[model samples]
Target: MNILTFDVEDWFHLLDHKSTKSEKVWLNYESRIHSNMERIYKILDNTNQKATFFCLGWVAKTYPEIIRKIIDKGHEIGSHSHLHQLVYEQTPEIFKKDLECSIKTIEDICGQKVIYYRAPGFSITKKNIWAFEIMHELGIKIDCSIFPSKRSHGGFPSFKNQEPVIVSYNGITLKELPINYYTILNKPIIYSGGGYFRLFPYYLINKWSKNSKYVMTYFHPRDFDKNQPIISDLSLARKFKSYVGLSGAATKLETWLNNDQFLDVSTADQKINWNEVPVVKL
Candidate 1:
C-alpha cells in the first residue's frame, strides 16, 4: 500500500529560521493555496487517484467549500495544526488546545470527525513524544507526523523504522504511519518528501517505494508553484531547504503515481484490524 499524502498549507506557513522570529508576518498571506490546489485537484481528478489531505484549520474555516470539495472528490481529510506551530515549541496544554481546535474546526466544516493528524514541519520528535498521548486523548486515531530520520528542523532519527507501526501511549493506541526511509550500509536514511524528494532523482524514490509496502509521499501546495514569491532574508540552510527543487517535482510525482498502485491512509487503515494497536516500547 503505497500512500501519497499532502500537507495543505500555504507557502508562507512554512517557517524559515528568520521568519520564526516574528509570526505576525503569517497573517499577511491569505489563501495562498488556491492555484496550486486547483492544479493538484485537476491532476488527481484526471488520474483517478485519491489521497489524504492534511489541511490547516484556518484554511478550512475560511474556505469551507474546499473541504467539501475534497470530500466530494473522494479524498480523506486530516488535521494539520491550526496555527502551524512546531509541537516542541508548545506546552502540552497549548498543544492539546490547538489539536482540539484544528479537529473541531475541520469537523465542523466537513461534518466528519477528523481522526488523523500530521504535525506542521513534521514536528513530532523524542522531546515531544508526549504529544502523541495528547492526540489520542483528543480522539485522533492516526498520525503521519514522525519522519523516520532526523532533519535540520526536527525528526525522530532513532525511531526511523520506515514502516507503519502502531504506537500506544498511556492506555490509548494510535497508529503512527511514519514517512519512508531506506537502509544504507546498516544505517536508516530518509529520502521521502520535502527537498529530499526534489533534489534527488525521482527514480530513486520509485525504487525505494518498490521495496516497501507503502511509500508515504508528502508535498506542500508551494511545491507546485514555481512563481511563489521568494522569502527575503532567509538563512543559508533555510534558503536551500525551501528552494532547492522547483522544476520537475510535479512531473516526477505524477510519473510515480501513474506507474504504481497506491492507497491513501484512510483506505489502508480500513483494511486492517485496529482492535490491537501496538504499544511503543519506552
Candidate 2:
C-alpha cells in the first residue's frame, strides 16, 4: 500500500547545516505553520485523502489547536521528536527524553497514543540504531526513519534494502518503513520526498512510484509555501536543495494524489503481515 505522510515543522526548522539561526532565535521568525498546514488540509480535504502527520513537539506545543484540527479532520498523528534534532546527533538518553517529550506533548493535545515515528531528515543511521530499542521501550511500534540510501544529514548506506522490514534489537521488535528510492546507474536515489520531490519531474516520479510495490511519500509545510523567506546564509547547494521547484510542488502533489490511493502508516501497518516480512537483527 502507498502511504502519505507529512512532517509538521515550520520553515525555520531547517537542517543544522542549512540553518544559521539557533532554537533560541526561532521566536523572531513569523510562524507560517498554521496557514501552510491549512493549505495542506484543504488539498487533502478536496482529494478526500487521509494522511499521517509526524509533528514536531515544539509545533504541537506552539499550535495545540492545529494538532486538534488534524485529529478532528480524521488524520493520524505521529511524533517527529520534540526538537528537530537528528537521531545520530543525540545520545541515547537525550533521544529518549526527546522522544518522551514529543509523545507526551502529542498525546496531551490529541488524547491518542502515537505509535508511529519519523526522524527529522531521516537521520537514524547505523551509528544510532540503538534508538530503535529505546523507541520500542517507549512504545513506538513503527518507524519511517531509515533512509536506505545515503543522505547529507544521516542515512543507512549499509542497509541495502529499500523495502519495509522488521527490525529486532535485543528482545524488542518494531516495523520499519524505510523511505523509498530507485536505482539509477547502480546508485540509489530517493525521489519520494523533500528536496528530491521538488527537484525531480513529475513524470519520472510517477514512473518510480509505478515500479515500486509500495511508496511512502512525504511532504513538509515549507514545500508548498512559495512566499517563505530564503535562508541567505545557506550555501548554494543547500539553497538549491531547499528551494528548488517550490512553485510547482503543490501542483505535482495534487496530480499524484488524484491518480493514486494512499493510507496512513498505522492503517498500512494493519494491512501487512509482519511475521512474513524479513527481519533485520540490530
Candidate 3:
C-alpha cells in the first residue's frame, strides 16, 4: 500500500539549523505555511485523496484555523513535537515534556486524542531507541519515525524491516510505518519523500512504486513552496538539498496523487492484518 503523509511544519522548521531552531527566531522568517498548505489542500481536493498530517504544536497554537480546516476536510492529525527539536539531542525528560505539550496542543485545538507521532527529521535512531518507549508511554499508538536507512539527523538503519511491522522495543510494542526504500546498485535508496523524492525523477519513482508492496511517504509544507526565501546560514550542501527540484515538486506530487491510490495512515492501519505482519524486535 502506498500511504500519504505530510510533516506539517513550515519552511523554517529545518532541524539542526540555528536560525530556525527555536520559536524565538522562527518569526524572523516569513510565515508561508498558510499559502503552502493551500497548495496541498488544492491538490488533495482535486485528487479527492486523504492524508495523515503530523503537525507541530507551535503551528496549531499559532494557526488554529489550519488544524480546524484539516479536521473539517476529513484528514487525520498527529503530533510532530512542540518545538521541532531532535529527539536524540534532548534528554528523555525534556523530550517527554515537549511531546506532552505537542500532544496537548493539538488535542486542545481539535478535541481529538493524539495517538500518532513522527519525530523531527526522523530522529529516533538506535542511540535513542528509548524514544519508542517514551512515545508509547505518552499514548502514541502509531509511529512513523523510523527511517530504515541512513539519514543526516535521524535514521534507524539497524531496524531491518522496511514495511509496516510490530516494533517491539523495551518490552513495549507499537505499530511502525517505517520509511521504505528502493534498492539501487545494492544500496537502499529512498525516493518516496523529502530530498530523496525531489531528487529522483518521476519515471524511477513510478518504477519503484510498482516494485514495492508497501510505501510510506513523508512530505513537508516547504516541498511545495518554491518561492520561500533562503536561510543563508545553511551549508552549501544543505542549501542544495533543501531547495533542489522545488519548481516541479508540486506537479510531481499532483501526478503521483493522480496516478496511485494513496491511503491515510489510519486507513492503512485498519486494512492491515497486524497479526500477520513481521515483528521487529528492537
Candidate 4:
C-alpha cells in the first residue's frame, strides 16, 4: 500500500539551520504557507487524493484556517510538533512539553484529538527512543517519525521494520509507520521524501515505488516552491540538497499521483492487521 502524507509547515521551517530554527526567527520570513498549501490542496483535489497532514502547532495557531481547511477537505490531521525541531536534540521533558503544546494547539483549532505524529526531520533516533513513551503518554496512537536508516539529522538505523509495526519501549507500545527504503549495495537508501524525492527523476521513483510493496511518502510545502528564498548561510551541499529540482517537483508529484493509487494514513491504519504485524523493541 502507498500512503500519502504531507508535513504541514512553511518553507522557512527548515531544521537544524540557525536562522530558520525557532518561532522568533520565523517571524522574519515571508509567510508563503498559504500559497504553497493552495498548490498542495489543488493537487489533491485534481488527483482525487486523500492525505494525512502532519502539522506544526505554530501553524495551527498562526493560521487556524489551514487546519480547518484540511478537515473540511476530508484529510487526516497529525502533529509535526509545536515548533519544528530535531527530537533527539531535545530532552524528554522538552519533547513532551512541545508535543503537548502541539496536541493542544491543533486540537483547539480543529476540535479533534491529534493521535498521529511525524517528528521534524524524522529525528527520533535510538538515543531518543524514550520519545515513544512520551508520545504514548500523550495519546499519539501512530508515529511516522522513524527513518529506519542513517540520516544526517537523526534516524533510528537500528529500527528493523519499515512497514507498520508495534513499537515497544519501556513497557509502552505505539503503532509505528516508518518510511520504506531501497537497498543499494547492502545499504538502505531512502528516496521517498525531502531532498531524495526531489533528487531522483520521477521515472526512477515510479520504478522504485512499483518495486516496493509498502510505501509511505512524506512531502513538505517547500519541496515544490521553486521560488522559495534560499538560506544564504547554508553550506554548499546543504543548499543543493534543500533546493534541488524544485521547478519540476510539483509536476512530478502530480504525475506520480496520476500513476498510482494512494490513501491517507487513517485509511492505511485501518488496512493494517495489528494481530500479525512485526513488533520492534526499541
Candidate 5:
C-alpha cells in the first residue's frame, strides 16, 4: 500500500549554507560506509522487504561492490546524481551532465539500466523544470524529485500537499512520485519520513501512515550512524533539522517494515498503472 525508500549516502554528503562545505569529504569514510551498508543489508534481508536505493553516483563509482551488494540483495537501484549537487542550482547543461554521469556509472556497476532518480534536496522546482525533459531525453522513466511540500532544504512551497500525482514535463509523461506528506484536519504536518521520520516519535509515524492512503517514506544510511561527526558551524535550524531524530532511525525502520506492506517505488508505480485510466465519467 506504500513505498519505502533509502537515500544511500553518508551524513557528510549534506551541503549546508554555513561557512563552506564540500562533498569531497564523503570519500574519506570507506570502512564506516561499507559497514553501514552491511548493516542495512542484514536488516532488509531479515525483514524480507526490498527498498529503492537512490544512491549517490560518487558512492557507486568509489564503491562498486557496495552497489553490487544492493543489486545482489534484490533491491532496486536508482541515481541520486554524481556529486549530490542540488538540482535547482545547476544550469540545464550542468544538470544533464551530472545526471548522465550518475546514470552511466550506476548502469556500469549494476549492469542494468537505471530508470529512477531522486534529485538532491528535491530541487526540481518550476525554475528548473526543464531538467525533467532532459531526464526523459537521457532515458529516465521515473522521478522522485518533487518534495510537494516545504522543507528547509529545497522544496516547492506550493506543490500538491498530499498524494503523488503524475505531471507532464517536456513532452514526456514520466511518473513523479513526490515524497509523502501528512495533513491533519486539512493542515499539513511533517513527520518522520526522511530526516524528520527518524527524529520524531516512531509511534506518531505509524499512526499517521495508518490514517493515510499513500505514505512514501525515505531514510538515509547516514541516519543509522549515531556517531557521525557533527557539523561545527551549522545554523541552529539546520543543526536541529539534521540531528534531531537520528538515534532511533534504524529501530523505527524495522518497526515500520514489520507493520506495513510496501513495495519499491517502481513496483508501486506499475501497480498504479495497471489499476487506472485516470478519467472520470461525466
Candidate 6:
C-alpha cells in the first residue's frame, strides 16, 4: 500500500532553528501556507487523490478555514503538534500540554477526534520513546514519528523495523508506522520524504517503490514552492538541502500521483491486519 501524507506548516517552520522558533517571530514572516497548500490541493484534486494532512495547531488556529477545506475535500487531518516543537527537546509534561493543545485546537475546528500524529521533524527518537505512552493516553491510535534510520535532527537508529508495528506501553497499544527506507550496501537509507524526495532521482524512487511492500511518502509545502524567499542566515548546507531540487518537486509529485494509488494514513491503518504485525514493548 502507498500512504500519502503532508506535513502542514508554513514556509517559515524551519526545524531546529533558533531564529524561527518563537511564535512571535513566526508572526513576523509572511504566511505562505494557504497559497502553497492550494497548489497541493489542486494537484491532488486533478489526480483524484486523498491524503493525510498532519497540521500544526498554530496553522489551524491561524487559518481555520484551511482545516475546514481539507476536511470538506475528504482528506484526513492529523496533528503535527502545536508550535512545531521537537518531542526529544520536551519533558513529558510539556509534551503532553502541547499535544493536548494541538488536539483541542484541531478538534475544535474540524469537530472530529484527532487520532493520528506525526512529530515535527520525526523527533520521537530513542530518547523519547516515552512519547508513545503519552500519545496513547491522549487516545491517539497511530503514530508516524519514528524515522527508522539516523537523521540529523531526530531519528531512531535503534529501531529495528521500518514497517508498521504495534507498540505496547502499560495497557495501551499504538501502531507505529515508521518512515520507509531502502537498503544500500546492506545499510538502510531514507528516500521517502522531505529533502530526500527532492534530492533523489525519480528512477531510484521508482525502483524503491516497486521493491517495497508498503511505502509512505511525505512532502511539505515548501518542497513545491520554488519561488519562496531563501533564508539568508541559514548555513550553506542547510540552504542547499532546503532549496536544491525545488523546481522539479511539483512535477515529480504529479508524476507519482498519476501513476500510483494512494490512501491517507488513517485509512491505511484501518486496512492493515494489526494482529499480524509485530509488537514492540516500551
Measured by lDDT, the strongest candidate is 3
Model 3 stretches with alpha carbons more than 4 Å out = none
List per-candidate RMSD values in Å: 2.0, 1.3, 0.8, 0.9, 3.0, 1.0
The pairs that clash in candidate 1 are: none
Displacement of the residue 88 alpha carbon in candidate 3, Å: 0.7
Q: Which ten residues in a row have the lowest lDDT in candidate 5?
A: 273-282
The TM-score values for the models, in the order shown, are 0.93, 0.97, 0.98, 0.98, 0.92, 0.97
Per-residue lDDT over 48-145 for candidate 2, one digit per residue giving the tens place of the 0 to 100 score: 89999999998899889989999999999999999888888789999999999999999999999989999998889888999999999889999999
Model 2, runs deviating above 4 Å: 17-21
Candidate 1 residues lying further than 4 Å off, grouped into runs, are 17-24, 273-278
Q: What would the C-alpha RMSD of candidate 4 be, to one decimal place? A: 0.9
Which of 2 and 4 is ahead in lDDT? 4
* lDDT, model 1: 0.80
- Name the runs in model 6 displaced over 4 angstroms: none
In model 6, how large is the Cα lDDT of residue 56? 94
Please say which candidate is ahead in TM-score: 2 or 4: 4
lDDT of 4: 0.91
Ten residues in sequence with the least summed lDDT for candidate 2: 16-25
lDDT tens string, model 1, 107-142? 998899899999988888888989988998899988
Give lDDT per model, in order: 0.80, 0.89, 0.92, 0.91, 0.77, 0.89
What tens digits encode model 5's per-residue C-alpha lDDT throughout 82-160? 8888878889899999999999999998999999989887887767888878889999887888776776667775776
